[model samples]
Target: MRITTLAKNYFFYCVLILTLFGQNGFVYSQCPTVTNTAQSFCDTQSPTIASLQAVDNGGGIKWYATATSNTQLTNSTVLINGEDYFVDDNTGNCGPRQSVTVTIYSAPTGANFQGVCVTSLSQATPSNPQFVINGNNLQWYTTPNGGTALSPTAILTDNTIYYISQTNPDTGCQTSRLSVFVNVGLVPTPLGSAVQEFCNIPGSPPTVGDLVASGNNNWYLTSAFGIPLDLSTPLVNGQFYYATTVDPPCESSIRLEVLVNLYEPNDAGSNGNRSICVNEIATTIPFDLFNLLGGTPDNTGVWSGPILTTNGFQGTLDVSTMTLLGSPYVFTYTVSSALCANDTSTVTITILGLPTATVSVSPTPSCSGSPATFTFTGTPNATVTYNINGGANQTITLNGTGTATLTGTYTANTTVNIVSVAS
Candidate 1:
């Protein structure tokens, strides 16, 4: 029995040793992992992945993707659309590695988002000033190139160039923009011009103190309302009238007429003291006057009548024909024109009565070489001188006109000169 038990023990020990050696001799193989190497391509309506995948020997797998070429799957994660895709090790086949590609479709949901804006109209001095546009961040360009753009609120900058576009966001198709322009200016102001015309015989010379006054009927010195005007100041002969207003560039003007006046010589006379005989002619008096006051003439004045008119009613009056002049004769001289008229009074003219006297001669008649004497005379108060020749200032003592016989002359050859003196 003992020997049989020992043999069983040895056999069990040998079996244990053989099992250990056999386990040590066997080899285990591991599979490579799979990964994604590229992002997906667009196929019809969906996205399919372009790929590289890896399977590890321990039945683990990972996948990666990149936008760039030649990227290794070990360092990259596959992104489809905007979401990230990771390696799925759920079906683990260790030996063979598989590849997967992720596709980005429908353009990541929000690419190239866009909006439009317009500029506002701006107020300017000129009615047609320029309008400019401003926009938010965008990758847009002008549609028509070198003209003008429509901006945020339709406000414009002057003399600036621009380009506007009506473009699609996703696809870069655009519509053409018409050109726009702005200018600067305002409405112009209006103006008026004027002239004048003169009257009074056109070209004839005027008399002194004579005035030619114009009438409104001839369109002289007229207002816009056609009212007759007495100017604030007397009108000057050769000057024009002018007035103005301050609205936009607008004014008025008209031709005016200015009448001129003339003045006469100041020949009005004044009376003086004088005396005249019954048959003497009238003498002219001398005087002159003028209107020192600012008085103008009344055209239709009347003078007291029964007055004789000659030489424009300016002749001398006859006082010499009055036979009796006791208290002195008085007369008046009157002068007139459109300006002024007045009468001047004369001083008295007195007349004296005549006187009577007698005359005589000296020397008697005698032949030549013979002498005789004869004498008679009035009071010496009535004395006389005699002359034989007709010399003007020569005087001879008047012995008598018959004194030629005393001198032995044949006939009386003497004339008498009388001397009368009044105190």
Candidate 2:
């Protein structure tokens, strides 16, 4: 009985020793060990690839601590797309007390192959960037010039002008646009001047050009209008002319203007009498004409000559015929020109045998905005009273030894009646 008890005790002691020393015999700890907690898979064409870990749980006489080894990869295995590979826990770093799971998944594929082609890679200002292929939807990222897919189609007019600028981090600069150039296939038309005034002179009609038109066609002028231009008429100032289109697309319109000039006439000089007889003497009266038109008037007339000293015309005509003793006669001399139609002057000489003041009252000419002046000359100490339209409004009386001058302005078209008296 004593031997039996001792043997049982020895057996229990042996089991305890084995349990303690079994764990400590191995230098490394008895923990599940994997080559790495995480890893990145390299981009490769291979379908499948595998890896491994090594570990030891126990031995015959001692419990070996957990041990790990460097990961080993297997490239020969067939890699299924979109599939995962689970490592065997028992055959790897997994211990009897602990187990580890490693998940493996296939990587995504590369971008679709769109042949190297030129594309408008731009995001126009005031317009978003967009990309389209034959008007089809596509996915692209933001590029240096714009984003991957351009938004809002660009309005291209000239098909020949195909240029795109781009920037990239890896590539300092580039223009990866395709070789095919986009053609808008249209040109812009030019514009012509429009006339402000119209003229009736056919020969000297003001000329205007092609007004602006749409499309790429060239422009020209024509006589398509039924009313032909009066080529014989001289284009006067303040006249407007029109032009008809003569191009392939006919019936267009244009205009032109002719500017006019305003001129002031020379005042009549003082004369001794309306009639002179026998050896009557005549003196040349000095006259001053203010050309206010800012230029010298053309004195191309039988009785008109240039002043030679200033912007004025000077001339003298013999009126001795009217002053001759011949039956008391009256004569009138007229001076005019075509260049300045509104500017004309007349001088009247009357051979009065007695003292008579012909007080004639008539309505003044109607002018839009011209100044009017009234004066009395050729009389010795003449006193005069004038009434407009015989009304009290605008009536004046003046007494002077020489010529009396009075001037006033008109705002609009006006009519005036004048009553001249000499006493």
Candidate 3:
């Protein structure tokens, strides 16, 4: 019985020792916990096998190309993007290997560029994108690589080659330099006087092409930055225009201001037609021909046509000397100017003859205290004034047939005479 008990205790002791330390006879712990299973890096960083080991929380990390491979990778071995690597820890004992994936991102690329004018380069702004490239965090450089970035307010030199690059914000990777050949052009100078004058026309007005300029001129409504005006743009009087000389894509930065002046001369007034009585002509004073002209005529105009006794251009007509009564005479006034055509207007005047009448008395042999009737005949619709024996004068209006009558109780043998008549 004693021998059997000792044998059972020895068996239990061996089983306990086997359970405490596995068949390798060493204490074991759980497989190394991968704190970061996947890693990312930029190509510029150039990660290596040692870089993967640095992240292992448990020390003594070993790296391999494949999960099942026994061959180990050296610490200096370079890592590749999108490749799987295996890592395990042997700090206390060997642990199950864990798979790791490395992702290496490439740098940003540069975009296309074009030539610009020197003036544009000098006045470039963020809104005015003269120099352009395609990427994030774009930077301009003097050299192809490893140089200080050009400042935003840097003064760019003309006819110089510039390098450009961009950096990736995600991985902090910078791209390779791209060559930008800057072809800076010079602005052309303008020549000629600023002020220009033109004559005013009725239908067709002056255009931009009509203005005098020295070289290949481009016109604009504004002095600065705007599209060139077409040659057909009508010029306005007292308005200003800008002129520039163009050198292909480049134009003069300083514009020449052109003040447009359109001039027009005064013209003769409108025509006039008038009538005058022959009796009043003898007492009429000589009057200016300008007074006869209608509208607002210039006083310096010359007069022509009929009935000018003196001074000709500015003279008046002497109606008393005119023999032909009831005749129409037309007088013309002409105005002239330096750059404008002559303007002419006419005035017509007609003279009317005096009216005539004959009187007859009814009951010519009437006795005293008897009523008397005096009848008159003259031109159609003529007015007459008469007196009975030089007494109070009486007036009467004639009928359409130029006949009128006066009734009065006059003394016997009284004489009645017609004083005046009019039509």
Query: Model 2, range 1-423, lDDT digits (tens) per residue?
Result: 999999999999999999788755452354434454332222222333433233433421111212333343354555443333333233343333322233322222222221111122232211322112321122222332344443335443322323233332222323233222332222222233443333223333433322232332322223223464444434434434443333332223432222333233422322222333233434423323322112343453223321122322443334444443444332222234443333334333344332212232123537545666655443444444454444564423344554556665554533344444443
Query: How many Å off is the CA of 349 in candidate 1?
Result: 3.6
- The candidate maximizing TM-score is 3
TM-score, predicted candidate 3 vs. hidden true structure: 0.41
Model 1 poorest 10 in a row by lDDT: 107-116
At residue 178, what lDDT does model 2 achieve?
28
How accurate locally is residue 329 in candidate 1, as Cα lDDT from 0 to 100? 52
Global CA lDDT computed for model 2:
0.35
Tell me, by lDDT, which candidate is best. 3
Model 3 per-residue lDDT at 180: 71
What is the full ranking by lDDT, best candidate first? Answer: 3, 2, 1
Off by over 4 Å in 1: 1-252, 264-266, 277-320, 341-348, 352-423
Clash counts for the predictions, in order: 54, 34, 1
All candidates: TM-score: 0.22, 0.22, 0.41
- What is each predicted model's overall lDDT from 0 to 1? 0.34, 0.35, 0.72
Candidate 1 per-residue lDDT over residues 191-276, each given as its tens digit: 22233222233234332112222211212244453533333334445544333221222122333333343333223344444555
Q: In angstroms, how far off is 164's CA in candidate 3? A: 3.9
Which prediction has more favorable lDDT, 2 or 3?
3
